[model samples]
Target: MDSEKLIHKITEKKALKDSKELLDYVSESGENTKEYIRYKTLWAMLQTGNEMDEETINDGYKAVKRNVKGRKSSLYINVVKYAAIVVFALLGGYFIHFADFNNEIAMNEIFVPKGNRTSVVLPDGSKVWLSNGTKLVYPESFVGDFRNVQLEGEGFFEVTHDKDHPFIVNVGKHRIKVLGTKFAVVAYPDDEQVKAELVSGKIQFDIHLGGTGDNYKSLMVSPMHSLVYDKTSGKVYDSTIPDGFYDYWQNGVYSFKDERFDSLATKIARIYNVEIVFGDEELKTRTFTGTLSVDDNIYTLMEAFKIASGKPFEYTFESGKIYINK
Candidate 1:
């Protein structure tokens, strides 16, 4: 009889009258037919909740024994293997653990560039939102006396308070220490400065910078205050700022009061990932003071700048790059 006819006959029988006859039929059957019988036999055993005798088990497995040994089995063997795995899992004798997880230290740094934003949790349980063009370097595992992290560019931190493990941020030569505080730091290397603007909670700064003898000169930041650091001059300027300044990163609209054109363009370049070229030296020196919405596209922002300054400007976009002309 053909394999299909044989399978139909096997399914029609409840139990074979003779074990030897069944084994002989399985041995003569094709791999597919043997697999089908194996599945039906296993399912029958499970439904009855009765363990088969050694002879009956051995006869049923013999049909698919070669496939199982070679890891070439069909649905029957797969079902059996998965059932065994589940049994082992429930027994708690074996479980997948950290040894299977990644243990290697992450080597590369993670950066969130302009016009893009990202959120990540640190090893110290602190949550950070990385702004565009921001670079954060942290170890895969934080090991040491204190939980410390390094940052370049800009980011907003919503730190998890842990009295035992104080959080420290290393930005350039300065160190910002806090037990728990909500703060934002804008420290771009090419920008020639770093600004730590605090929204709430107390923060202390240890300025490695000289000429700042007193703590008042070195550290003077409170709620709604910004500590501006000039890398070239080694000076710190603490100024009172309104609460809206903190919302600029989230809202994508910045309100500048007497902000210089050079400074504003640097921010624009980073946020839009574009280059602003102005041949007019006078225009370059002109300071812009107003509320500008960074949520707008490059063209829209350029229009806003033109309206604010009345300077005719033009721009074009390339592969992941933008160029401006006047």
Candidate 2:
């Protein structure tokens, strides 16, 4: 039997008459075919909720075993071995079903361009404010035990409250797990630091040092707290943020407290849709603590920098690029 027909039969809960043929196909199938079977079976089980009792599970095992009882071929032995996994996948969806497992789950990707900010209401009624130059990937409908999403750049999330299903955000090398909370995440691939600032409720921040599950450290983030991870040094530190600092950017104003110019330039470039070229290295070291409205033009924003620098600073804008010198 072909994989499609086999999957249809399984999904339809039809009694197995061609068990031997199915076993033969599974035995000769490659890894991808096996994975497809597992994914389809799990998806079907989720939809139908065909909970199998202990007796049924045991009966399935016994039936498969009896089919291969007198067969001495190594291929039959392999089939018997693989049948156990297939049985479990059909009976109970207990295996590792990652966010990428369900091929049928529709994915929606939203990109907020360099000069614009946008907001999206997820299917679960969660609201997300995507900052400029942000890429957010989420499913049309969340399945399984977690609401998983991927974010590049920055975003503010107000996740819907679901105690049973935690909301997880994958940002760079870190994963932020939350349960109906409002938080902000900054994790640009080009940046040296990744930060997760919690506005309310609690979250768990996990830093995967080497992209391996075993080499990771977890931090319990509380309300009004910011967890910063240095990508270069593999160091993590937690500090307190102001009451409204996290969500301030949503209103077209950015507030920074003693933020370095070099670090701030990335955000400024993204918000203003301009490339900032610093001719003087010293300008990168300057730190400023203030608020700037994103609605202002590039010259106005550069004038603010000049006043903050307390020195003669000049800039030239040409073809969407700003060259700054002091």
Candidate 3:
């Protein structure tokens, strides 16, 4: 077929008589013609006001086959051309017509470094507040059996639950299942423990870290409840989380009730992107019980600790390290 004839057929001005010749021409056309044929045929098939039949659909496949594989140089290549056309046809259909792909898909990822905070929305109508040095992966659209997302570092999730599709948040070695619930996750690699604090509704916490992973059970809880799974202890501690603790992230406050200095420092490190070294082993082992506002800089937060402990902490802004002295 001539170039003009090809264009006429693509423009739908001329009817496709021999689907074989049209297919061959599409298969051997140059890059520009190949793209034109691919998009034009796609638009022809999918565009509103057009009723696509088998011949036009076959032409669409032929267009994709030609565009994806360029020109064949051998007889064997020609023999396999039909199979390649079928593959491209199915793949193109999935890409353009798949409903799941059209909705809540994670198209990009955002990372929040330590000493920072970020807010993000998932494909579902859920909101997530990512704590410092956290990574969240989500789709641009939400489809399939469950609305799921993977979380690293720490984050607070306010999920908009769909009864047909449960929202699943995957933290390191732990999974939170909820339909519509608000909760916070504190899990850092440097820390020996992971915590999930529920603010409202109910959540199912699955402890996936154990000798026999399948032997572990799931714990269901409501607001003011918490589940702390410790890796070193091989235990999941359930407790009534203290008031004001759940709102810490939102209010720029961090509350610790008799939490050891080492664990507390780990949390601070993730939030502030700072390296805290304890000079005295005893001081590092000391436990702190109080509430400090993170709104101020690290120095100010340390000052609060100093008054509570009756000790002074000297930190160097240049070195990003802190020292406790009595």
Name the best candidate (by lDDT). Answer: 2
State the weakest 10-residue window (summed lDDT) of model 3. Answer: 95-104
Worst lDDT window (10 residues) for model 1?
Answer: 93-102
Tell me the tens digit of each residue's lDDT in model 3 across 109-204. Answer: 445566655465454557777667776666545567888777777888888968889988777657888889888887766677878889898889
Q: Rate the local accuracy (lDDT) of all candidates.
A: 0.59, 0.70, 0.62
Clashes of each: 2, 0, 14
Candidate 2, superposed: residue stretches over 4 Å from native: 1-102, 243-247
Candidates by lDDT, descending order = 2, 3, 1
Model 3 regions lying over 4 Å from their true place: 1-107, 209-216, 311-318
Instruction: Write one digit per residue (lDDT tens) for candidate 2, span 48-153.
Output: 2223346655676677887665645654544443454457544432332223423445355655567665565665778777667878777646788999999998
Q: Ten consecutive residues with minimal summed lDDT in candidate 2?
A: 92-101
| CA deviation > 4 Å runs, candidate 1 | 1-108, 210-218, 310-326
lDDT of 1 by residue, 1-326 (tens): 44333444443442332344544554454553334334333232233222223454444455445444443545445444334432422332221111111232221244555655555556555777766687776543455556677888888888888777777777866778877889888877777777888888867776664445433234757888898878789777888876467567566667787777767787787777776665556667777777656567777767777777756666566775545566
In candidate 1 the C-alpha lDDT for residue 201 amounts to: 82
